[model samples]
Target: MMYRNPAILTRLALLVPLGLVTGAPAAAQEAVSVEIVPGAVSLAVGEEVTLTARVLDAEGNAVDAQVLFFPSFADGRSGSARQSIDVDRATGRIRAVKGGEFLISAIVATARNLRGEAMVSVAFPPVDRIDVTPLGGSTYVGVATRHRATLLDTAEDERDGEIRWSTSDGGVATVDRFGILTAHAPGSVVLRAEAEGISADVAYEIRENPAARLTDEILWRQKEQFSDGVGYSWIDSLKEMAEGEIGDGQLARAAARFPTNTPLTKEAYLYRSIFASHFPGEPAVRCAPEGPSIACSTPAAIAWDPAFAGMADPSGRAVQGVHAHSY
Candidate 1:
């Protein structure tokens, strides 16, 4: 799109192909028009192109005038549009940073109204490889984990594309379109991610959950779970009693009392106070189990059950027969 404002500049600037410019006399220096040479061009990523601006008189004679060049997206988009191409105002040298089409404008600095524009199109290279992290690893049945895949060009430049995920043995483990893998049974399987005809694979082995196995080994007595190992109502009874034993004000000041891993519940406060009476040392307090956990499971095992991530209790009742796996 080009327009001339005769009201702003007496002379007109015409954008045209590169051509010989005849010398203009001092009087002819009042350009009738200005133009940018090479009206259009196309280049690949990392390529460079230079544009020339000429202020011409009525007889197509070159005139003297300071010209500046600016680059903008042809489609009028912003952000990455500015990142796609770079231009030197004084030299009109443009470098393609990414694939996109842009318009290069050459304006007469003195007149401000006389200007010319050129079109430039940049091409992007193809994806040459796919890289997946944890190329090979092991997980447990009933456990889930997320994997990531990145696309790269031959030059190792990162590229953007949609990835399709799949699993070789669905019975053992399954992968979703977003690369989340869920272990269904015990076995070995291959996880694959594909994009632009390029694919990457990750080998995995699903084993029986050791937490579930440990329960089977030590489940001789009734309810052999933490917090409820003695009886299902034991912890509940203690919680009910603590609600009366500890006042609201005391629980509010639990942080000042225990300092480390401050008790958040009446049941927790009751237990902490009792433990402090027996072993009243900062080191012993610090040794108390802390961090996120579920059903006596380790912090890492919490990943297996998303619901466990925010759990404060280490009781085994939520996951009745499960415990943290040593492996």
Candidate 2:
């Protein structure tokens, strides 16, 4: 059965156990009223406070009695989701867990229990910083990734607080309340998380997904092959001219001339000589692609075929099995 007054139920719940343990009759321990010293207090999370309880007899004389502390949410509700406080039963010491108000009831450990209560207010500690994961990075358009934001106090201890997530450019990307980032288009944007007047940002770049445009029909329509599409004889003539114009001794000296990405083939040497005449610096060389590649594929794609690892030619026909005769 539910008691209208929770204090009455608390007393009833303790009577059976205390009576059985103390071997004291229900009428032996008598108390007219009880009072808690420093009846109200306010503190921050992780802070502690101690309370003292006193019992008085009908004659207004102080009585010696053991007191136990119990916490009930002052809002008249009890649930695990609500912020909680830890109270020591034997010693009226309380440790704040989160931001909330609580009512601490002190019961005299007796067959006839007399209760006293105090109010407690707890506030969250101030946030010193907000740390975000994957600080600044790149992702493909239409892809989604989860980001984390951690709030810390001045002591570098994690503090519990709500975080607000936002994107600098909504057109480029969007972030939800939980810090899940979704790329909408190809662009650069900044993601921000804020809490307790402290905020942090992460730069993100969203690029187009190349796999979506690799269809055979699109490839045939683009007509991207520079020399082969025009005439086969033209590329053969160019290769023969490069072989006669560049000697092996000049190819060996290619590295001394252009330290960055020295040409291995005579054709590559001829092209680098022409290009270097116009732009001759490390900055210009960085603008051009220079890596171990095959079949116009990236250096990472060399793992697909063992032969690709040894081939330096970037022609699409260099790949043995993948190239179709129709192309």
Candidate 3:
């Protein structure tokens, strides 16, 4: 039963067993009597509460009583599901059926002697929902494909970042303590995020990157830096091409700014395979002129079959280039 001070029941769960006699001492005994210390009551749907029972002789010494709780949901609510658990000798747990009133009860027996029953009402909480953000694209092979999600209250208000994210795809991806995802291999993964009892989920794919260190370095160096009186964005250092928006002269100077930055390389045929997997209507060319090997695609047109979409970067325009097809 629910109690005003819960610790008193917790202590009782542990101590109730101390008074029972087992094995050698009980062979010659008469029938033991059992009675539930806590009594019965009504509860709101989905409420959780605790129960405890005691077995004793007519003289009032605690005896060994085996407790067994039966399902007795309210008349029409019998269809609701309930689960009960024993935490210790004197205490057990019970959850009420959902969405309606519930009648909960418990029983115990000392040897073959049946004990009395007891219960109390608990109110079940409400249903809730959550929304998860996309953790798309491959982060070099063997890393988590993660999605960020925000929690929502029952009223649909966004709760602060008090979220717990998990996954069902242990073989494909693993989640870290801070909700960062790591791909375990080249395959699909499903991720889940939850708060309180509410939950939501999404799925994505991941693969290994043969050029992981190099890719990481490029992504890392792109962070803002002050090379001189002029501050540079890491993208300003890559190969540049003229877009409809930016002129070739400006693109050339931006490309010149970081002549020292290394070019991203194709490590394996697998790289081509992944790039080719882009969806239809993706941009095919970005860093260069509309060419054969663009990574992204423009929305209004579909160009080459192998080319998905053009990838745009801050780097200046030079000669047009293509990223190879995915393996």
Candidate 4:
């Protein structure tokens, strides 16, 4: 009584296009997957990174959708990515935010046709926002050097806000007008930058003074002569010292440099001592020898001005050099 021959009585037929009645076409299926192309590691907090999202159909044809990505873990930090657009639809490229693993999502919806979704993950590195720079890297001693200290947001600070500055060698160099530092001597210095009391330092190396070098020929060229200890002026040599030590071989160098009349020579050494003490112009402190000078003992007695407090020997005795015989 069970269907003993139901299979023999029934007939099955294929439904196909009228032209191809022997076969049928397969139905479409869904193909939605997410992938992140290339890896992202560290990045400056305010820097940019190129990100992409892709879509495809089960048949291997390219699919279109709205593409956008953001950091999965912002850690409560403020960050942003470029707006989602069809550019990914056209070129498949976009930029992402600052930090953490990014969750890239893409959504596509059609009016009852098809829908697609995708997600990709990427990590963003941190960035430093502060920046500082100096102006006119080179300078001469006794001349002012100017510098501009700056702190920038790296992302903003379009207003060009105020910047604070300080230096290690303020005495040797000072900042003014526009953070300009006038150099004093051959040495190194530092400029410290601070904003709201937070600070950073940069190195500045000042080299030895070239113009300060003392030379004989150049002195001669300048036609500089001694002022006889009366006043300070540019001179070739000891117009003031040569006369005082007259033939004093110990002062041979100063003598040759200045080689002057008696009165002028004695007075020059006096001037030399006073110049050294009062003004910081001369590089050396004292040049006169420890013993009595020939001018003191010879008839060619100098004005013997006590005004040059430390010019003579500690004993106060006056002797002379080879030129003493002339007196």
Candidate 5:
């Protein structure tokens, strides 16, 4: 004999002809229930989540049945009708199309109409791109500039997020975590900003200040003044050469005559005169040209002069009338 409740019979009568209710042994026909795995979920727009429904008999045993999944908004309207949720009926995959809360249901059609549901809350989309400002420019050493990083969403709207800033060469330039750049030396460095797996870079150059160059020139001039027998006139000439007052070739010839190993003194003018005669240029000082050896020196004479020559002069110009002085 089949024990039946009037309410269940009425439900079965209303559902049976639709092929939604299946007939089976009384034990197998007991009231059924559904349990949805992962009772709740959270996702972002354009993100997907998988849901599963398990049907159980009244005795708490698992059973197989054809299940269908659907979604509804908080207002009790169909989510699909509102175009906010997409469902794969065969696989029970739910994709969020917009930012909203939804109730997703897995239903097993039967005499008892067993069903289970999960609540899904979809958040706003994450940032897809990062934009950094002051892209390419130069800064003077020891100067600072403020930079900015803007985060943009898929729709090109500005969004808010944490950003990280860095520089490729810390010695040339440095950026703080908040994107403040400071130039430390003369060179180029790449600045970068990162947010939500997206990154942007800007190339920057740091240059020496004009005042810094002037200071370096002053220090070099001071060092030259301490040399023995190197008069203020010679130092002034070197300063003029550095300032482009003298031509490159002339300056090079003048530098060739300076004593290297020997202390600069009056006798140093002899080597200067010898170099001037062979190179056809006037020396810083005039020397008598007619003496033993014609008072003009050979390239080897300058190269072997223990007081003047520390290294050989590559130019092998030979001079005949040369004299060496001991003063």
Candidate 6:
């Protein structure tokens, strides 16, 4: 919709078009008046608004002519030279480049000259501040947490803008574009959310996860169960039990014994302990009792020789009714 101001109409009456004489000869010529539709405008920076100028003869009849639009700052600086406003010389369409008030003129030159000017106020919605939710918190490795970023404009209105998320140390934690943070290792990292030129930062810490560690070790052992490698099918079952079936205290106890540096030996021991604790005296290995002593064999030892049995005790006595197995 177009809006015109009565005060601006009163000012336009005195300001005649340049090169048009106010003498009797010029008065005899058709008097043309330029009416700037929508005498006032308001828009945000980088926004576009259309301004139309109506050229009328002395009889108020529409007259078609070549119209040129000129834009200038309120301080009398050339807006075109400063690149603050873009004018489609062909059409009177105007686009604001920055935030400021500008005076736009629509001028026409022919046998008679006509001119009209209007005011345009371009504003910029500045970001006053940025806020990040869950300010600072802790999470476990292999866990994910959702974060939120809010932008407050100068008007104190909340605006949802496109945000870019980043982490100070990607090795410790990573954040997606949506601000979902995934912890990768045990460390602290600064999570940053940026929109426009404003940014907000929050500290996030990742703690070691015993269950995840144990599960990773068990998976590694499972991958080694190929070809002639020692089979560790029980490790998979132990992982499921530790995750949900077993009690937290029991799982924690088993996880405490997990090796940090040398994983293979420690993982094997941990699995065996879990298996033994759950099913005690369940004959982990089969043995043959020969006279007063028992001959025990494991899957690995049996592969070497069918008649092979376990070694004797340190006291040089026959291992009586005792069986042993190797993982």
TM-score-better candidate, 2 vs 6: 2
Q: Write the per-residue lDDT of candidate 6 for residues 173-266, one digit (tens) a residue.
A: 9999889999999999999999989999999778998786566557644222122133334444544554565455554454354323111222
| Candidate 5 lDDT by residue in tens digits, 1-327 | 989899988998999887777776344545378888888999887889899888788877878787888788856753252377788876789888766688888887653356888888878666878888877688899888899999987756577789998899999998888799999999999999998899999998788977676775576542311321354455445434444543444445544654332212223343444555776533433343422111134444554545435322211111212211111
Q: Least lDDT summed over 10 consecutive residues: which range in candidate 5?
A: 318-327
Ranking of predictions according to lDDT: 2, 1, 5, 6, 3, 4
Off by over 4 Å in 4: 1-130, 135-139, 154-159, 214-327
| Every candidate's lDDT | 0.81, 0.81, 0.49, 0.45, 0.67, 0.66
Give the RMSD in angstroms, all C-alphas superposed, for model 6: 23.8
Better of 3 and 6 by TM-score: 6
- Point to the candidate with the largest lDDT: 2
- Provide the TM-score for each candidate, comma-separated: 0.53, 0.48, 0.27, 0.26, 0.32, 0.33
Each model's total of backbone clashes: 3, 0, 44, 24, 7, 0
Evaluated at residue 6, the lDDT of candidate 5 is: 100
Candidate 4 vs candidate 5, TM-score winner: 5
lDDT by residue (55-102, candidate 3, tens digit) is 666677776646765544455454533542212333466654433334
Which wins on lDDT, candidate 1 or candidate 4? Answer: 1
Query: What is the per-residue lDDT of model 4 for residues 215-284, given as tens digits with 9 covering 90 to 100?
Result: 8677544221223233232222444444554455534456544333212344455565455576544233
Write model 1 residue lDDT over 194-280, tens digit each, in one string. 999999999998899987766554765444466566665776687679999999999999889877988877877888889999999
Q: Over the stretch 104-163, how does candidate 2's per-residue lDDT look in tens digits? A: 898988833579999999875667899999787899888888999999876566878899
